[model samples]
Target chain A: MSKEKKKPILPMIIFGIVSLGSYFVLFNQEGLVTETYTKGGWYAAFPILTAFWFSFVHGSFGSNLLDVVGLQAKKNK
Target chain B: MRKVAAVLIVILMILPMATAVFAGGPPPKNLKKGIFLEVNEAAGTALFQDSTTQETSTLMIGYSVKAEDLKLNKKMMVSFEEHDGQVFIKTAEVMFLDLTLTKFISLIVVGLVGGLLSGFIGSGGAFVLTPAMMSLGVPGAIAVASNMCHKFPKALVGSIKRYKYGQVDIKLGLVMAVSAIAGVQIGIKIQKVVLDAWGNAGSNLYVSVVFVVVLVIVGGYVLRDAFKLSKNPAAADTQSKLSLRLQKINLPPMMHFKTAGVTMSAWITLPIGLATGMLAATIAVGGFIGVPGMIYVCGASAIVASATELVVAFVMGTYGSIQWAVSGLVDIRMTLLILSASLIGVQLGAIGTTYVKDYTIKLVMAATMLVVAVSRGAKIPVYLQDLDWATLSPTTTAVLNGISFWALIAALATAGIIITGAMIKGMREAKQEVQVEESHSKA
Candidate 1:
């Protein structure tokens, strides 16, 4: 039941930027991350939270990108 | 009233199973997680600090351990054994893996294809990804842990997409997931038993045998059923006789799943969940069995069953991730790298499913399963070589390993092709139909 968005390109670019930025930050601080994230115990939430954040930002971007490319689900028949 | 009762009963059944399993804690493996506080090569000993207890121990350097590789003040996971009343370090690994360009690209590629398969069929990618990571020099536990960490998110994104298509059955998926969680415990326990009994080679051989046997049987049956359904479209919507008979049973606590459109006793779904959990624990992919079980045993259509599987995957993956996380083994960089591509692949696959028929899902799943069976089957002889049960030439072992890795690639590639082809064809036909309708209306 996902209706076609009027202009997915704009939102796609925005999300793409955010997702890429997130990755950039993650890679930029690799040593700090690799240390803290793998510390076990309550530090488990770090990875879980990161996974959710990317899935939302990156996931939406992927959905819209697919829409822009005309690779969409069949309209409700 | 009955539905609530049935669900509660199911939960009651699951709680005890989970507690019983969790109570056992992880098998008493000699592996410990901590940091190397100091090393004295001349003394043939190292002072190690336990992360949890803040206690230090003097561990003797075993013959297999490379003393030079031990860095002071670095967090690590190591397995040690008692050799002649002295605790000896066996293999020590740095907690985090060094991800090079090669490792990054490979993770992304596998994640994309694995995501596509998961979005379309609701389960896949773990089986090959774990081994693929190991090949890239990741520790076995870390590879499995990182792969699991990625799986939940991918499944979350995928399930949402599929749910939008109204294909996912929340109640049924939850029912299966709760039990599947318990089953993972048993699976881990069984794995521990195997490892303790026969070591790595024996474990690999056990996993490979189970992988090949299950895939051949389930995949073969699904493929056959797909052919039958494709030829006879009228039978597509009907539940299997097994499902129908099971549904007819006048059992107490019969739960009605609206999305799946069948009412069945809660008891029936538990075994499937347990089996799925056990297989997932053994082979790293439960969707191979989960989807088929939902279809044939629970009487859901392929579309619904596959979509619902994402829910199960999400729950199980999250649970698995937490377990790995508590052990601090999840490699987030590898997880995110895979997600970088897989998140896209999953959505694309989810939409692709909307453009195709149910049979296409089955066909793709069957093909992947059979090829994956080949991938694991090829590794059997090499595992045999390791166990000293069979002496394989070096060339033979190398060739077999090559075939095994490539065959996994083949499985994903085959599924990707089928899904893409079907979606494209479906889109073309839909567009053509729209154009025809527009023309007729204008006239």
Candidate 2:
């Protein structure tokens, strides 16, 4: 009897929605983003914070996305 | 106990260095970020509101700034010159651009490939990404800022993955980064002097010349080493004779890098880190020198050097990003757009390392360095013409520019193919071994 491995479908879907949603919101508010993000001073934190936020959200999505596609590191012997 | 104390001392030493140069090099002179409220073309001036202070000021237009280029009520980044106490707008650039499909795809593709290269070799992709963004009509400064904004997060991800594999040496990375930061300051000062002396063309010429010379020498040496190791796969990975000899020197403050499996004097290690930082500031690709320096001089294996490089990249990238962001130069749209794909690509590349041998990493790094050297070399003639040192026809200039761009694409494609091929091959062999063992047990 052979057993098939399960795909990370659930996590992929969850992160995919969050990632896409983030992009949608950012692009929709492009004018406000440009103004606030480039303000400099204490406001300079805007771009740095946004980058960290995406790295967590979209970065996780990408990881799950790769697993769903079956691209993963080989098991160590 | 001694090791912990040494590490603490190192951290303490680095803190003051960080605080001293945290502002990073020198700020660009006469540059301002603001929103244009109104433009009076007839009067050759515009009502500009500073983004930070929200203060209103009339900026006199310079002769080079065409009246039609001024768009009312748009965010603009401008450079100014004080002529007899009158502020003249020397150059103006739109801070944000409309996100079109072509640009989005281009950025994602480049980011993915660049992330892959970075994950595999520790540092790369930025050397090409900055120029690629500029080609897509982003200003050089903005392209650099956005590239830096994307770099740290990607490097952070890569470093975390490599750390899980037990390949990262945090101490070595930190020690190097501390001095690298100081090196970046000095490098920037040198760049400013060159820019002030020679203008944009001169700067480009200087950068390209350095790129070609360094890449050729270092890439050639690495490629030769990779070939030697490829021919002798059974041989143990060892420190070079240079590193072995240097390790014998009884200099004070001898440091031990646990993961890299080498102990050397701080005197030896600090210079390598400093050179890495200086080159990073100069050409925006410090990894080319940093990795090779670790492998050849510091006596770390390519794997350790590359993995540790992710740490260096993380530290320097974070520091550099903050400096650029504080200047309000980072285009977050471009940064996020690149991150969307690079985050994925970096993870894949990091995993690829688990499947391949050390020489494979060196092979990819060498190939990339040589190809990128060619790409930069193609731009030398254009810079020469800009400096009035040489003349070239417009057609020739266009062809060279095309070659320069395509050569970068070629470098990325070549690296991607080699990495994928090696990973797949290694995985297949591992699977075969697993099957053989299972069959034997069943029999």
Candidate 3:
């Protein structure tokens, strides 16, 4: 039980850093990002792809962060 | 292999239809996103630099636009009307608001609560988040677009989590989504007819009336079913009588949905999906009808219904976001900000489901629907007054508006409290059970 309870601290830290880095890059390049993203053709894929990318990276970071903090679903019978 | 191919073929067929139909409805007409460089109130014109092309164009402001409303260097979305081959700005407003500390915090807070509710109920956030953003001074079109942009990712995360828990029925979700796309087209046509015939006020009245009627009827039924299930635990997982009767019909093209554990004819399932889509186009929250329809009409359990609704949300939201994005309506900054907190909230809510019974989901959903009904109900009189069908004093209008807004907040707050409380109780019970098992092993 003790071994099973080990927290996922390392993965959480790595994902947290990567997620924050991605956010910083996007925010810093807002002008170029907004311009390229809204061009109304193939450029439409930009927002959808970006959303998926963030959901994967940031979403993993969030899930790991919760597990590290000891929030998890109870094992079903 | 055959089943997989069939599903893929269906999705491929529906994709183009969805794009063509839903494309023309939302984000208003001839709208352009740009930054306001100069507002020359004296000349009734403004110099706007297009965000996409960086081209500066002087636009003639319509009579209703106040010079004070135009802020320099702020992102703006302007709607244009072509009169005598000259384009004039019919409406112009700031697209993205300044992200001050207070507004930032408020958005994150609402995102978290809205995310939690969505995770629990399968469809939420848009009903409240769009209004919340509009109240913060974001243009209505941008708010809807940004909200849609955030929705798909959030739904994607929640659906994947629930899928892992064996709650989602992918086949059912896809079938429903395909039919829903068609329904949205019809719903949009109805909306356009109303808007053209009676204008914005009539449109608002139509939406409010539909909102109240649907919420009251469906929410009351769900609440009653939830109460009955709570009273008799043995009947908690039983299919509704309506669903059982529908399933008995030997209609052609019967589909088996394994996760939902239901086998029903295509004829029955498709109508529910279509209605869900129609309601979604009208109210911007299709899950209100979709989840209930799945449970009571399609013989799905509440858990499966809610989880499947997430799948439908993912499909529709992704499609809608792309439409809005191409039109340059989505404010990515706002979308990402909401996603930042909602991702966390959604994961937590998804986990919360493991600890509670199926009735709990129905209860939360019903409670939310009823409260939201009150919120929209409060706006009906205001809309009627706008159409000159009813007269309302300024103070009365103000009070009704306040009730409408606060009722939305109340709905969010109530769901949050119920989810959190139930999760804590569930976790405690599980911990105690684990402790008891440990003691038994020692003995």
Candidate 4:
């Protein structure tokens, strides 16, 4: 119970904020993002690279959120 | 030896079909990637700038495509046919879809469940997501492209999670993935031949039929095995006799996968990978065939087979996404929206596996595959009607479409229920055991 109480809220919040920020930026600039992304050449990298960014940032936030909620894998030992 | 011979015979069989396609088939339809430069409403013609060559050509827009709907300067994918020295556009789809509130929520919901399914069973979502997005009014190519763009990263996250639990075999996954790419080429070739002969409706019918047949046979076998394994938990970790026999074969270039604990001839794995790729190209669900082939043919246990398949999915998804993105077909907005939920779902699913037995994974997969088969089966009549082979009233067509779409929803719902139920039950049992051990040690 004490260990549960000690779980960090700070990093989770930080990650959550950044994840939300990234999504906001993309949506807010939807027109530019779409135009640049669909340029059909070197611009193709924009979407692929952006996907990688969200996966890492948002993925980390998800990990922390799950941990805070007490869901975890069983230890073999 | 006979099993190996049978696999060889199957490949040989596919060769003739490939040759037959090449020898005498209707001209393949031209699916070009380009942007609309100018739309002349009066002539029902549009000037298109080809994405690849930067060449501008005039295309006659079919009556089905409204001129008002054409968006100039937007990247588009056009399906056309060359007739008597002129290009005729059958369909022109703007690659990027408008992200509406309804579409946004739907992508997240589907992404989360699909991710969970993929994480738990090793293969899922593609069969359901593409159709689900299409139902939400996204064009078929955009839906497929965006779903694929989201898949590789989800697979990467899921595979990494499973790998931490000592479930993945990179060597095995890489071997299968490389061979599978070759299979994709052949599958694409076959699809082109079908498209040339019967056009869009025919192509859809071909895909649906293959989807139904493959899912029924493979899913049925896995379900029966799941039942057997559940009845006798002690045998859950045992390898099939086929794997044992194949391991004994003295073929050269034997590759031993440490995590899967299998050592077999390299020759044996290639055919399975190729078959998986072919299935993937034809149906857009390679993982469906890949995981099962790994288990039944390569002799890997279900747990290892499913986990290794994540590696294959990651590789194939990345490769496929690049191909789509290069043509500017990927709707990044949709891809990100889905990933927003799926990344989380995938990780949760990966952890859930640690609580349950291998049979649980097989059971979830079997359930998903069987229900998904029903979903595709319901669409067969609709496609038949489109081909004019069968006449149906408008109401019947609407009813069939409803059945097809709802059946997909049902498959997702069923799989979600079973996976969550199994995970909860398993997690509760694990916690109780941990508490008991802690108390005993303290006392």
Candidate 5:
């Protein structure tokens, strides 16, 4: 099922960089990002936006982390 | 091909019919819909107008409030009188719309960790998210709504990953999800009634009691089973006698599940799903019982049972999110924030399953269940005090609350460590095997 292709490493590296960058932007400076999220109502937009942002970025990081560590699910078909 | 088409048709038909049947109740006639105009204490009436119908109505809001404290001009919500009766302002809570950057960061951090935990355990981290949101000044209903909104997508992602690994039983999951949704509706009704009659403190006490009792009993049984299997790994493969007997019951309308490799009466499966849904509504930990019930009672292996639970969670979560969204209570931020980490966490957990023996899942599940039981159990005394049944010292109350919160953190940490350790070991072994095969091919 793998088709013997060369394992792609760049996607994993790009994901890592972006994930860390987002984390820094959100967490730096007296928790401004978190404070804005809890202000309620329309401020809730902050949390929703960040969540999607992290899901793509961190999700890719995790997926590739598994790949780099040689932990893919067995291809039984 | 005919059989496949027949199955698809049955699914399509049942999906709508089941929804219509479950949605049988009439809409709340006394549901007050309006924005508050003024609070008049002398007449004890809160002036409100229906936003949709554009009808002005003076609603005798059931609860008492001070006249001067009413906020005007902001969109305030109100509920109704008898069927086709006058609408009254129920409780006009303020809707604020300012968020600092700090809350955004916290949601991501919490969401990532929560997602990671959910990915690993199949259930958890949500209990903390709801409370965390509430602590961050979100209302109780909104916290739950936001959390529910996030859950379905996370479960969907997790279920797909596990399905790829040959772990999910789609047929079993659908059956369970359908029944579970019914259970949730009933559970919600019961909860609403309790809250109305007994008030918040009483409702909280009741929830704690159920959480403590169910978790302890279920957790104990699972722990015992895990220990037994650890002592004799071969025993994991053996079918339980009860399940063996259940398989023999030649009842009509029997259903077959390929991944689960079992065919049983629809009647048998429905109750399990119902219980899962009801418990989910009550405690938000449906997977805790759902997975074990499928394994021990329904006789599927832990791998398939736990994986199938993701599908059930997805279906239920989506329904719940829509309901919450309709009310505009779902804080999309909280939902997506949790999804961020949880999506990844679930994938990792699904893959982790491939490396461990069936008994290992049991061990992790039992350990989590038991520890979480302790967390809930610690809160019982606090609830009892709230009910005024017992008088406790302030220090003792504080200590118990601390223990309850910390225990939850401990449970997550322990589960995370164990799952990561097991996955690492499995990955190493798999790589060694791959290397061996490559060298052999070269030779």
Candidate 6:
């Protein structure tokens, strides 16, 4: 159980850093991002791709963060 | 295990085929695209620009219309009429640019709170989110589409978090989602029949009535049950008679859900999902029914039911998002902005679940539902006025709209408090348990 618990921590920390870093870029650079993205046609892929990309990265960060905080579901019913 | 996996794959493969066959006709292309440069009333023609290419064009009027009909400098979608070999935009309806910075901020805030509520209660945020978007000046279709796009990823994250906490029943949730998709098709068909008969106002009235009535009835029952359970604290952990009766069906092709701890016929399971999908299509919140159906009809405990809802949400949301994305209506910035906060909120709510009993979910869900019913109830009068069935003074109309908006805000805030309070209490108790257990092990 301890081993299982420890496994998620390192990945969580790494993901956390990356997740926060990406947001810093996206939110701060909203003008450039929005301008480039809303150009229409093929460029529309920017917003869609970005949504999916965050789902994975931010999602992982959240999952690991929970595990690192020792908040896991009870094991073995 | 392999056989179980095989069944899952088979069920998944059949769902899309079923939806395509039964989901009825495609959504109407109500998009009217054009830009106006000038209104020429003398010739009854408007100098307009095509939205796509921005090319200038002249359209002659078919009906007798004045220059004042066109709102100058405002881009409008015009109904075209060809008269005397010349095309004219007959009715120049301005394309409303209702999106404001304030609305954008409101969307993000509502999305975050809704995400938190969803994480705790299984499915709710959309019921409120869609209306919130509408109030923010998003067109009805765009609001629903954008909300759907946000839903899938939010559900994905929420599901994973809850799944980690032993709340999700993957096989069961997937099976229900398939049936729910089929149900959405049926619901859409029914909507078309109503539309054909009574037109748009009638359809809107029908939807509002259904939302008000269903939410009131179901929400009331749930509230009563929650109250009763609270009174008898020991009963909080027990399953209901309806749940037990559902568990005893034992018909052929009975499926076992180990986590939910129930086995029932696919027949029993399919209808719940169908109802969920139908409601989702109407109100954009399928999980409200889906969660309760699992608890009362399928005999799953609240924990599993809520967790599984995230799965259903993920599936439905994904399909719904794809439909919206294809229409090019999804505003990705809005989707991401909401996700940023919601991802964190969902994680917090999911972990919060581990610290409370099943009834806590019930408490939050019932409260949210009842408050939301009030919000929708407030809108009935406005729709009534729209259809000319009833007349309201401006003050009354403003008051009604105000109450409707504030009630929605109240619902969000109420749910937020309940969830937060319960989570904190649960966390404290969980910490105590861990400390006690550690001491015992040391001794």
The numbered model that scores best in lDDT is: 3
Task: Rank the models by lDDT, top first.
Answer: 3, 2, 1, 4, 6, 5
Sliding window of 10 residues with minimal summed lDDT for model 1 chain A: A1-10
CA shift of B337, model 6, Å: 1.2
Q: Score each candidate by Cα lDDT.
A: 0.85, 0.86, 0.87, 0.82, 0.70, 0.74
Between candidates 2 and 4, the TM-score winner: 2
Worst 10 residues of 2 chain B by lDDT: B19-28
Query: For residues B246-354, could you state the per-residue lDDT of candidate 1 as single tens digits?
Result: 9888677777889999898878988898888787778777888999999999999999999999998887777667767766777898999999999999988898889
The residue-level lDDT of candidate 3 at B441 comes to 89
Instruction: In model 5, state the lDDT of residue B397.
Output: 95
lDDT of model number 3 = 0.87
Q: Model 6, B307: alpha-carbon shift in Å?
A: 0.5
Q: Which residue pairs in candidate 1 have backbone atoms (N, alpha carbon, C) closer than 3 angstroms, thus clashing?
A: none
For candidate 4 chain B, the 10 contiguous residues with the lowest summed lDDT are B19-28
Candidates 1 and 2 compared: the better one by DockQ is 2
lDDT, residue A40, model 4: 60
Q: Give the Å error, residue B169, model 3.
A: 0.8
Q: Encode model 4's per-residue lDDT on B159-183: one tens digit a residue.
A: 9989999999877887787778778
C-alpha TM-scores of all predictions: 0.91, 0.93, 0.95, 0.89, 0.77, 0.84
Q: How good is the docking of model 1, as DockQ?
A: 0.59
Candidate 6: which docking quality band? acceptable
Poorest stretch of ten by lDDT in candidate 1 chain B: B19-28
lDDT at B151, model 2: 92
TM-score top scorer: 3
Candidate 4 residues lying further than 4 Å off, grouped into runs, are A1-8, B1-62, B71-88
- Model 6 agreement with the true structure over B342-363: per-residue lDDT tens digits: 7777777777777777888888
Off by over 4 Å in 6: A1-49, A64-77, B15-28, B33-104, B438-443
Fnat for each predicted structure, in order? 0.73, 0.71, 0.63, 0.63, 0.18, 0.23
lDDT of model 3, residue B119: 88
